[model samples]
Target: MIGWRLSGALVASGVLLALWWLWGANARLSDDLAAERAARLAAERSAVLARRVAEDEARAQLQGERLNVELKRAAIGRSDPVPDYLLDHLRGLGVVQ
Candidate 1:
């Protein structure tokens, strides 16, 4: 009877330890998955932000080119006799002063 009780206790302790170890492993797996998801989201957001910044930079460059063209046209027009079209454009820009 004593031997039987001792064997039962040992078996119970082994099962309990195994269950604890499995639970710890499950917890670790859950944490790793969560971390991976967060990293993926951060990367996706960063990619989107980078794309938006590039688009903004392109728009700004186009605007700068447009302004430079307008300035050159105005400068050339001013050096010559003003035509109706150039006078109208200067009026539109409120540069009559």
Candidate 2:
């Protein structure tokens, strides 16, 4: 009878240990999944920021080109008489008013 009682206790202990191990594994997996989701969100935000930066750079480059052309035209006009088209444009801007 004592031997049977000992074996039953051992079996119960083994089952409890197995349940504890499985619970820990499930908790660890849950944490890992949450971490992966956070990482994915961060990567998406970085991609959006990079795309915005690229668009801003392109716009700046286009504006720089336009300004360069205007400066060159102004420099040329300084050495010659102003054309009728420029006078009309100045009037449109209220610069000649």
Candidate 3:
């Protein structure tokens, strides 16, 4: 009878110890997961910011190209001859006949 009681107590203590260890491990794993999630969010934000900057730079480049085209047109003066396509269209309408 005494042996039975002693064995029961030993089994209960082992079960309690196992539960405590499992709880600690779970808490540690949760902390690590939270840290990883935070790092990912930060990285994503940086990537988004980089993309916005790239888009802005591309828009600026397009604007510069348009300015250069306008400058070239101005340098050529407004005395340029009319396009042949325009003359054909006007002749078709009898305006240039």
Candidate 4:
């Protein structure tokens, strides 16, 4: 009877040990899955930010080009002959006397 009790106790201990090992492996796998999900989320966020930055840069470039074209047009359309009143003011200031 004592031998039977000892054997039963050993079997229970072995089962408990196996359960503990399985629980530890499951916890490790859960941690790895969480880390992988976090990494994927970060990569997705980075891609969105990169796309936004590229769009902003393109818009800025287009605006800059439009402004440059407007400046060129204004420069080309400028009249060279000064107004008479402005010429008289310059003569009064002795700048064109």
**Ranking 1 against 3 by TM-score, winner:** 1
Model 3 local distance difference test score: 0.80
Model 1 residue runs over 4 Å out of place are: 78-97
Give the poorly placed runs of model 4, Cα more than 4 Å off. 78-97
Per-candidate local distance difference test: 0.82, 0.81, 0.80, 0.80
Ordered list by TM-score, greatest first: 4, 1, 2, 3
Worst 10 residues of 4 by lDDT: 66-75
Highest TM-score, which number? 4
Instruction: Encode model 3's per-residue lDDT on 38-70: one tens digit a residue.
Output: 999999999999999999989977876664465
Model 3 poorest ten-residue lDDT run: 66-75
Q: Residue by residue across 25-93, what tens digits does model 4's lDDT show?
A: 999999999999999999999999999999998997787666446545644775354556865775575
Candidate 1: lDDT of 88? 77
- Please write out the lDDT profile of model 1 over residues 1-97, one tens digit for every residue: 9999999999999999999999999999999999999999999999999999999989977876765566667667844445668657856865442
Better of 2 and 4 by lDDT: 2
Full-model lDDT, candidate 2:
0.81
Cα-based lDDT at residue 85, candidate 1: 85
TM-scores for all candidates: the values are 0.71, 0.61, 0.60, 0.74
State the displacement of the C-alpha of residue 23, model 2, in Å, after optimal TM-score superposition: 1.4
